[model samples]
Target chain A: MISVRGVHKSFGGVHAVRGVTFEVGKGQVVGLLGANGAGKTTTIRMITGFLPPDTGSVAVAGHDTLRHSLAARAAVGYLPESAPAYSEMSVDGFLSFRGTLYGMRRRDRRNATERVLGLCDLHEVRRRRVGHLSKGFRQRVGLAAAMLHDPPVLILDEPSNGLDPKQIGQARRLIRELARDRTVLVSSHILPEVEQTCDRVIIMARGQIRVDADPKELLGSLREASPYIVEARGDAAESVLRAVPGVERVEVTSRPALDFDGTAWHTFRITAAAGAIDLREPIAATCAARGILIRELRREAPGLERVFLSLIEADEEGLPSPPGRGRWPADGRDGGGSPGGAAPQSHGAAA
Target chain B: MIPAASAIAVREYRSLFRVPVGWIVIALYLFLTGVVFVSSALIPGEPASLRYVFGISGWLLLPVMPAVSMRLFAEEFRSGTAEPLMTSPVSDASIVAGKYLGACLFLLTMLAPTLIYAVILAAVSDPAPDPGPILAGYLSLVLLGMLYLAVGTLVSSLTANQTLAFLGTFLFLLIALLLTGDMAARLPGNIGAILIRLGLSTRMEDFARGVIDTAHVVFFLSVSAWFLLLAFVAVESRRWR
Candidate 1:
């Protein structure tokens, strides 16, 4: 339903979106994920024909955004980032006006307004001025306006930004419902919301797409590449743990027992080699033979947060990796002290 | 395309009456025009007519027209409603034409109540006022309002600040109104004569004298169309940035 090709946009001397390309199919809900200044909004503006891209083109349902803007815009239902509306107008008045702009006839406009009002659950406050409503209600008003024309493509930028939990849930459900027959592209900085709502995820960083994959597949591949964690306590536990087979490196987490109090415990996190055999039993057996007490031993399952952070970190470091192996390069694998590397280790217990 | 423009025109016209500023501008205009009519035009010995009333209202529109047109595009930009508006299927020319028409309609409403004064003049005069001059005078007022509103609409499209739009439009109309006659008289050769002939106020005098020259009508319409075109260009320039 939407095709963007090598779209590049710059403001003044700064490039906001550079050579970004992606396609969204019909009935697909794609989540655009990025931190601040990632060009998500810029890319969206280009697609919506609100801002023209400097170089490449954006087409919606075969209508070029720049060449045939009216037809392309007619196909798009855009909800801008802040969901701005005419504050002096009532909800019904605003919707009716939108319908008129879309060239709907009077009877059709009235029916569409009533349909959207009920669909967005805005019937109760339909008569109230939009400025007098709360943020959630105002968001619904924007959604209602966007849906008023029944456009085939919906582009919403951060639709769940300031809403409460319940409202966010409602927005997610509404988006899901809208995506049942239309193409929906939703951009958000909230990772979990995207994970829960999108069928496919596209991660952007510094005006480029860093990673694009299915949410489950991305997480699953990252989990398969994750390292193992083994904590042991006793005299010389670090050396014993490091001596085991298939152990790549062992980094001790804390200072060893001092003053001979016999109460101090030492922990070591282990990173095993690719295709290495199960090191958990081997490490346990070694610890037992060495009179070391095993405190904890487990393999960490990488979650979406870790995958996202790793992709961003890799992008920032200018080391673009193949989709799955980008998390930790072989040579740069220090035991877990790297920035964003500690998240997976700490969250390992929960997984 | 006409339907789209008309839809926007209808909305703009309805919104004019929905707000207090529209009513306030109309009331203030009628009050000032009524005062000017009673003090200057309604004399005991002089012949009863709407000559002074139409002229004074034309001058009054120098300020009143901007008040009505200042918010035409400035408010939309300031409130961020321009995104929804521009993203819609309507073309820039249609939007500009619709808004200009709406402002012109409001100006007509402001001029409508002054007709009562014309009625009173015809009723009380011993020799009834000539209907020809009265019709011409009203036509001149409509043309003058259209030109002013078009200029104001162009200025509004240039800025997001309503105050700036108002002041800019006021200064522009002031220069257009003040510069042509006095400054044109001082210039040398045919340029001076042509400039004086182009003076808006000078052209308006013929209409009050009940002479509807095609040249004057063409001038008013061409100027209004020029400003509306400029507004359309100003709006379409957003796509480049």
Candidate 2:
């Protein structure tokens, strides 16, 4: 439903987005992730036809954003980052105004306004001025305005910004409901929100797409490559762990962290073999059975944060963007960090 | 195009009444025109006509119309509401036309009460005021309003600051309508002849005398159109920047 090709945007001398290319298919809810000044909002703005890309093009619902901006804009329902609205207008008044911009008839406009008001849970505050509402309510009103026309494509930048925890959960559910038949592209700084709500996450760094893959793919890849940290005092720990079923290899990472009561306390990193069960339970049981002093055994949970940081760090070091499955440990070894040398280096054609 | 422009126009017009600034500008304008009405139009032994009222109102609009138009685009930019507006399917021309029409509606509202002064003039005078000059005077007022509001609209589109828009417009009007009239008399030749004709105040004099000169009417409309066209270009240029 949306295609951005070779899009480059510059503000004065700063290149906000450079040679960025991505596509969001119909019915796909894609989350855009990035840190401050990472070009997420800039990219969203270009796609919404609010600003023309300095080079290249953005097309929405088969209409070019620059060439047929009106048609392109008509296909898109955009919620800008801060969700701005006229403070003087009532909630219903604002949505009705949006209806006019979309060219809906009077009756249709009233119905759409009523529908969005109910959907956003804005019935009680419908008659209140928008400026008089709380920040979270204002944000919902902005979302309602975007949905008022019932456009096929939605490009919301930071939709969950000011909501409370419960409201954020409600917004997540609302977004999922809205994306049932529509294309959605959301950009936000909140990682877990994106991880839970988006099917696919695209991570951008320094004006480029560094990682683009399914959320599960990224997490699974990182989990397969990550190693667990074990801090304990045990006899023959390395050979003992390697002999355990489902254990791939074990290595002593550092000298004794402490010498407490005449015994050295050391740290080891344990790696599990490919398709092996989680090693935490098995490792602990084995240590207990053998009378080894077990202090800590914890696997690095490979969530979206690990993958996001890895791609960004790799980007800083001048590595190309991924077919990020390349970051997985194809050799079945643990790399154990977001920017492990092997993960980004192996990145090429592997998906 | 018509629907979108008209919708925006309605919003803009009604919004003027929604906030205190809108009512404040309207009241201030009526107050200034009322003062002009009492001091100039109601004097005994003077000709019972709106000629003086129309004349001073031209100068009155020098600052008043800018106040009406200063917020037209500047406030949208200031509050960041321009995002939803500019991103909508509406064209830049429609946006400009809508705002222009809205401000014109406001100008009409401000002028509506002044008509009562005319009724009083006709009733109180032994020789009723000639309706010809009264109608023509109003025609001049309307023409001058079109040009003045158009200037305000054009200036407002260029900046995000309301004060700058108002000051810029006030300065431009001062030079084009007032100073040019005085300058045209001293400077001789084709340049002087052109300045006199182009002087907005000079043209108002013909209309106040109950002469609806087609040249003056065309001049007011064409200049206003020219200003509005520039405003359209200014608005469209934002995306590129």
Candidate 3:
């Protein structure tokens, strides 16, 4: 539904968007993931025809944004960052005004306003002045205005930024429901929200796309390239498991059931081979020979959080690392940490 | 272009009615003009005229005009509401024209009640007030306000801070007003004439005296158009930056 070719935009000496290019297919939910000031907003402005790219072009629904801006803009609904709206206008008034700007008929404008108010759960507050609403309610009002015309494509920037957890969940669900019929491109710094809501994610850093892949594919790649997590039950389990071939790290867990039963039992999680090996079978066989009962022996899959951290690390290294893969081990052995190497890590994980 | 212009005009008109600032400007202008007309005509015991009324109001708009136009684009830029308007299908020229018309309509309303002073002056005076100067005076007031509104709008487009926009535009008008009298004379004769022609008070003096020179009218119209065009260019430049 949309194509952007080598789009570059600069603000004076600062390059905000640098030769970024991507496509959004019809009825697809794509998340434009990036940290603050990653040129996502700049790229969106170009695509929506709000600003022409300094170089190259952006096309929406087969219409050139620079040459046929009116047609392109008419087919796209944009929710700008911060959900800006006229404070003096009521929720209904703003939506209707926006609808009229999009050239909707009077009857259809009213109908669409009502429809979108319901879609964004803004019916009860339709008559309220926009300035009087809370952040979450204001966000819904912004969303309703964008959706009022029922445009084929919806571009939202940080749609859930100020919302509470419950409201964020609701907004995410609403965005997903919207994608069932229309193309949606949402930008956000929140990684898990994108994983749950978007079918594919375009990770951006600096002024370029770092990785663009399906959520499942990213997760699969990470599992194949990161440490595997394993758990088993045995005497001296921590030491024994740590000694197992390919085991890089091991930590102990308390069994509350055993404590309640007046007996001591321990659980250990092991990090092992990251690639071309299934440590579960070897660990199971080792445990069986050692008379250690294998209570749980499974490979832990990497979630979006891990993949996100890994990609950020890759960006810091000044290279585009494969998606779903963690930083490569320096010793050429998977799951082994090199204490001397300057491995990039998140503060959250390091703490 | 006309439909978009009409839409912006109606919306601005409604906004004026809804906001108290519009009423305040009108009421203040009327009360102040009433006092000036009474002092200049009723107290002097001379043939009554609206010449002094136009003189005071034209000078009064130096501050008042900026107050009204300061929010024209500044509020939109601050609130980020300019995005939807800029991103819409309407051209920059249409937006500038619509806003100019809106401010002009407000100027009309402010000028409308001053006619009451004209009527009251005629009723109590020995000689009826001259309608010729009154018409010319009102025209000058409208055009002067237009010129000021355009400058205020261009200043407003340069910043998202309303107070800064107001101060910046007000200072600019103050300088322009200063150039009309003793301050402008100090300059060389040719430069002084240019400044005098560009001066709000000097251009308005021709209309206030009931002499509607085409050159003066065109000057005011061009001044208004030039600032408005600058405002349009300023808004368009932001997208590239």
Candidate 4:
């Protein structure tokens, strides 16, 4: 359990984190999403008791970070960004030393080190110097050092930065497994990894919280507010579907059926208000009234990419979008408006 | 505080002996002290007393202490490990004291072999050597090392570059050492007497003459405390940044 209230941090003339506030409940895996220099690491540092906030307070498991830093730090297991480690120490020795610093007894320190080595998949290289290991292994060793104390909360800054895809997947699974009984706050720039690993998402931009919601409900609510695409195939399906009320737009396509002796099948795509009475019901009723049998009808919902871009653009343009319904530009694409249209991918995400 | 201090002390001591530079420092210190000891005590017409030998060996600390304390906090800052250590449960005083003790211990190891100088003088003397002066001289040498180490620790905390730490601390100690002796007499009236009395050479005079003055003891202790406090404050100021 962690509570951060109106935390602000600045260096020289630059404001790194500005009045950010959020709470993470026990056993919750929260992903801190942000662009480069978006204050994610700064926020993590404040929570971990490394850098005290310039203007607010952080409490970890009821211990005030400023007033009772030792207790607060005792409750936190932090893996710093870049996996910075003691170069001269071997994997086992480093973990042991970190364990001692965390106040573990020698015997318990060794036991915890052994357990974390297995959990992070670092047993094979336990005897090797940390500087001699590969980047992925070094990251794993960093993870082990953090987990060695068995702290109730884990704050990891860019934990999956340099790992390969498989290693990232392994780390994701490990975080999820660890989150079963502890709080996890993982910061990352990679959106999908957060989507795959975190239970809740906190998107930050320009030193402020842009959006915070369950990844599923957030996207679903956005989809309900945006345009819904419907495809139908039947005799005069295009006109019949377009005739229904609330059908704001329509596109028609024709394809010849190979088994039907070259008889062309008509398909219509209808775009309408999200909850306009499931346009299929009325479209089917109208088709039946016209004696045109319907073949297929399916609704295509907008993806999360649309919702995220809409929110970010709204944030950048200084526009006030709807509270829960994220605003998006019509042509869903990545930020900066690149031409080839390589946008973030989205799939079925429900709360 | 003791637990944290001991934890840091053990770590520092281990790193010193485990690395190549640690041995190199000890070897280099012994060689330099040997050269100075022979030039002052073993020369053909030089005095048989090892007083000059101990005195010059005290000057040997001018350059040696920077090597020992340059990496105290500076290397930690540069390597980024300072984050975890500073964020840990340890206090600033404990960290500074631990590092100072580590440096002192290294200086002691270097000073250990030089005791043979006193032994040689005792063996080849007209009357049995007065072990009092020998003991007092070694005590002053240790105090001088502590004073330089405190300054070096403070300098290390001021910058992350070890080279800068070395140069900064070296210059600071040199200035502090100069202000207390012949260098001070050239200045004004009462100030010159006070500076001469406080200078390393003047304070160490009683010890070289086989008399330990409480004033000199208090002076070295005060100097050690002042610099160590500065080092602690320097380290704590990092919390603001």
- Which regions in candidate 2 have their CA more than 4 angstroms from the true location? A231-291, A316-351
The top-ranked prediction according to DockQ is: 2
Q: Is candidate 2 or candidate 4 better by TM-score?
A: 2
Among all candidates shown, the one with the greatest lDDT: 2
Residue pairs with clashing backbones, model 1 = none
Residues A1-351 of candidate 3 have per-residue lDDT tens digits of 989887778888898877677788998999887767777888888988888999888999999998887888888888888899887778888887787677777899889987998788888998998989998898888888888888899999889977899989889888988889999999887878888899888766667765566776656655555554444544555666776787767777555235454544566666655443667777777777776665566666667676556656666775434333334331122342322232322111111
Estimate, for each residue in A1-351, the C-alpha lDDT of model 1 and write its tens digit. Answer: 999888888989988887777788999999887778888888888898889999888999999999999999999998888889977788988898889889999999999998998888899999998889998888889988989999999988888866889889988999999999999999887888888999888777777765556776666655555677766666677788888998987877667644365655766768776557778889988889889887678887766677667667766776644234434231223222322222221111011
On the 0 to 100 scale, the lDDT of residue B230 in model 4 is 95
Candidate 1 chain B, which ten residues in sequence have the lowest lDDT sum?
Answer: B176-185
User: For every model in order, what is the iRMS?
Assistant: 1.3, 0.8, 1.7, 1.6
What are the runs in model 4 whose C-alpha is more than 4 Å off? A222-316, A320-351, B18-20, B43-48, B119-128
Query: Per-residue lDDT tens digits of candidate 2, residues A174-263?
Result: 999999999999998888999999988887777766667688767766676678888877556666677778877788888875555667
Per-residue lDDT of model 1, residues B44-135, tens digit only: 99988889888888888888999999999998899888888888888889899888888888887888888999888888887989998899
* Ranking according to DockQ, highest score first: 2, 1, 3, 4
- Which CAPRI category fits model 1? medium
Candidate 2 chain B least-lDDT 10 residues: B197-206
Q: Count clashing residue pairs per candidate.
A: 0, 1, 2, 2
Give the C-alpha miss distance for residue B119 in model 1, angstroms.
Answer: 2.4
**CAPRI-style grade of the A/B interface in model 2:** medium
- Pairs that collide in candidate 3 are A221-A324, A222-A324
In the predicted model 4, the residue pairs found to clash are A310-A327, B180-B199
Interface RMSD of 4: 1.6
